[model samples]
Target chain A: MSNIFPEVANKVPRWILFGLTLKVLAIIAGLYYYFTPSYTRAGYQPVQPVSFDHSLHVKQVGLDCRYCHTFVDRSEHSTVPSSNTCMNCHSVVKADSDKLALVRESYQTGESIEWVKIHDTPDYVYFNHAVHVNRGVSCVHCHGQVDEMEEVYHAKSFTMNFCLDCHRNPEEFIRPVDKVYDLQWEPEDPEWEEQAQAFVHDWKVMPPESCSGCHR
Target chain B: MNRIITVVYIFLIILVVSVLGFRGSKSRKEPLYLFPDMDRQARYEPQGENPFFEDKMDDRLPPQNTIARGNALDRAGVFSSGFDATELTDVAFNTGRDEAGEFLKELPIEVNHELMELGRERYDIFCAVCHDETGDGNGAVKNFAPPTLSSANLLTQLYIDQSEGEIYNTISYGKNTMMGYADKLSPKERWAVVLYVRALQRAANATADDIPEAKRGELGL
Candidate 1:
């Protein structure tokens, strides 16, 4: 038979096969990196109606986390403070400032401020702020160094794996109950591991690893 | 052919990097959902938005004049009148006042070390920001506030002369330009704060003679 195929035909088939393999590999790599909560959820900084500065309130003013999040240790959900809580200080301190105009209006109108929420978990996952906080989990563990942030952002991935990592070994994360609100707190003792283990034992912090524990 | 393949690979890499960017990069855009699958249910969450309501709020305020359940007077033993429990006219524990609408001279709840400790914690969290740790009205907030809005000096003679219930009322309903903490502090917590405030007043006014004989040596009084 005459040379039915062109001289480049052999190279063309090989190149096409190589390109298909590379395409598949690229897709796998893309999904592996981009599908995670780390890429999708973390570092989400939303613009709030009023530019509330956490560093100013927490670092300078020296207010406790519970001062505004009063129900953190008492209720399932840690509530955002009402406009009245802002007016508590602003009414006297910066009463006429333009920055507090929205707060003043919300207080007078008895309307809820449209503050954007961060760190939202999936609907199926049931997370309780009081349960974790009461068990010596510091706010900084999940929320990061909010006392230093000028604008709050989602600091942690909050993936199921992230939660499970703590649940599996809570002794690695637990601190003194009194120091839960003290975000700057660190173990002064060199033998901090022993102290954490002791807390896990004494407090009976048996985090459920079963699916029903969280999904229910 | 080899050169063409190499160039295509490089282009593909640049495309991916430009589109996805780096992980955890700061972004103002909302998190993109690849597999939303029941991630956000239709059910209402606490403080969630609802288009159905005029206020666009899922959390509705309780109807007017409706007190939440489970707020009954359980700790009125300290100031219990001779009257029977059923016949008790005024719940002093909740109101911080007697049936005659007068502030109670003393706390209606029994004071103890536990309650005092709770008072210290709650006071530091809610009151010390403005009232100062020593009740001197010089707190972190005082540095920012005008002289007219300065927190009250709880150790002053004016405050010392006030009754416990009056102090409780102030903590609950607030006084002057101060906003009420009734929402933040429960009735028992308000009383605990009152006890702590009284202790602060006593400590501020104490003399060398007031120190206990055993503790005096510790302070070298």
Candidate 2:
């Protein structure tokens, strides 16, 4: 039998082929960026075991970030506070609330309540809380205004490029070492930027952009 | 040529459709790790259970008297006569109450400039959030127009009448909505905070006579 529609095969219009190729390229480019880890993980707010409201504790109650993250400035990892920290106030404040049963049980039994990690960095990337915090990076810079968050979520894409953006220009985000914990602090005046520059100068802050900076 | 074009077009369409149909975008699933190097390690995590230990806990307790590095002074026995009911004079640990269970009227630790400085620093970190920087109790926490320090709150005549030891007790075992700092602060630091609170009260309530002789001129007292 004759080849079905033989003329259509060899003499197909070049413009249609070009148009199809362009569409395929567009689809690939769109999906590639859309499905990137940064885009996919930007707002991954997992449902926590407890409905802990950061807004209630941090914003309304005006608790400092360090109140719960007790080791941010001293240790490599910023650990989640123990149940005892919650019981410190809950034992008296909301002593009988059913919502805090898990906290009470954990505190009493000396068992830990498993808090879901929000800002999870990959194992290959070594992130140190003390280094960043002690060097004048405020908690809000990377974590967003957690005080305003009703339920805490990962605020930034903790990707390599995201980290390198700040690591490359340390001065723009730097503040006075004392003001590092002031999550709400802003550049009050031109002098504030000047002060940050001075701090960067005085402390000799060099956020390394090398592979070993985080990879090690 | 036509068959080849059709095959290429179909392949591209299939790739695009499959990628687009991946899953619910809002689902909280992590992306698949194509090269998940060290993403999940075998190392023990903090507070994670371990069969190796008798208690099955990864966090091991220090072997009995392992005094934390900075807490060495906590065990120096600064108090000569505390809750033991002894009549010693040099004791700084008063347990913050009298026999009647009322707050003590005297501070066990001596109030000095160094102690006040330490107190100021610790207070700023721990108490300022709720108690505010000036200890007016108007800390941003309550958001309900908390009473100023000199008013009828914790710094007034009723509270001031209590001994410094009583204040220390209040710090150790928090009263009302305030959390106890026994875990967060050392005992000496608590006493220093008490002294600092007193100083804050004095500063807030100072009259012409309370000001120092030299600084009085600057204040136009």
Candidate 3:
């Protein structure tokens, strides 16, 4: 009875094995590339109740980040400005504009504007806005150049590794304390590296690499 | 066999490209979490919704007629040298008034170079948008604001004649069209702004004699 059929029969088994291997590799590659914070969370742009333009307020109008986010330097959570904060200017400026109808209503009714949050961390991560801003970590680092964004969107991956990149070497990112709010500020001096290192040392910006640092 | 393999490879490429698209492309949909893990928990986040409350707000306002606990004046004393234990009992620091219920003529906190610098920084952040960088009425908002909403020029004679405590009260509680910044600025910071405003007033009205003989040359006066 001997050797079954033709030599091509043996090759058919080999071809099927090769195809299986290719299919497995493709699936693994797809998962590795697509399932990451960069792909999933980086570009979330939720619609807010009001179309507040950051570029107009921050870049052109020259409002500081603290003008609206008043508690950023003092509290763990950065306070979203009350509608009263909006009315502080809008009540005088665009008092009758249809665009600001929601804002005017919120101010009058003493109701909170349901502004959708963009940059959110996992529940376990205890990130403090005060500690970062006070330690020379500019808002531009994590939030990106919000002064340029007309409608704010997530600009960076807030994954554990993304955070670790700065924590491991804060000298690469931290700027002068005075320049933290100035997003346009760039280190023009050739000795910026040395200056950043000095700031890291002086500020004692030893961000923890251990789990407890953020998790707890 | 070769033809079949080629077809399979092409199919895989199309599948990956179509499914993955491109990273960082804008999306209105919520992020899809594969594992989810504990990305969100059953805890109340700041500014989050709570159906348990009648207002459906997790953050509750402080009850009416309740003053914050602790020595509010004493807390401000930590930042300045002028306040003593005797002044802790006095409501002057918080209210910007004296025992006579009149705005104090001088700052409750001691004025120093550091306080002045802080004042300048805070004023630029909080006030310069409306009050202008040089304490002039013309600021970025002046273009949009009507005459009724125009910010007061701190350098004007009206502001110069005002007492330090009166200026502090204005900064804290706001005047006319301006809104109160009591929630935004601490008592110590309000005092610092008052000092900076006084400096601006003096600079605006300075005669050649007002400048120091040594510093006059710096200005090419």
- Model 1 deviation from the true structure expressed as Cα RMSD, one decimal place: 3.9
What is the per-residue lDDT of model 2 for residues B1-221, given as tens digits with 9 covering 90 to 100?
55776788678767866765532233355545545778767667655657897867787877797865534444336544434332232244636666666666666666788998989877877778666787676665444432332112445676656678877877788776565777677677788888888888787777888877999889777
- Misplaced by over 4 Å in model 3 are B65-89, B147-149
User: TM-score, each model?
Assistant: 0.91, 0.72, 0.93
State each model's C-alpha RMSD to the native: 3.9, 7.3, 3.0
Measured as a fraction from 0 to 1, the native contacts recovered by model 2 come to 0.28
Flag regions of model 1 displaced more than 4 Å.
A1-18, B64-90, B208-212
Write the residue-wise lDDT of candidate 1 on B89-204 in tens digits: 34798788898999999988878998898899999999999999999989899999987667899999999999999998988998898889999998888889999999999999
What's the true lDDT of residue B90 in model 3?
52
Q: Which model scores highest in lDDT?
A: 1
DockQ of each: 0.81, 0.28, 0.79
Each candidate's number of clashing pairs is 0, 8, 0
Local accuracy of candidate 3 as per-residue lDDT tens digits, A1-216: 787778778788888898889888888887777888888888999888899999999866799999999889888998899888998888789899999999999888877788999998889899999999999999999999999999999999887899999999999999998888998999999999999999899889999999999999
lDDT of 3 by residue, B1-221 (tens): 68977897988789778877877888898887877899889998888889999888888877786656754545663546564554455578878898899999988877789999989989999999999989997889998877656788888888888988888888888888898898888888888888888888788888999988999899899
Q: What lDDT does candidate 2 reach at residue A170?
A: 85
Ranking by lDDT: 1, 3, 2
Number of the candidate with higher TM-score, 1 or 2: 1
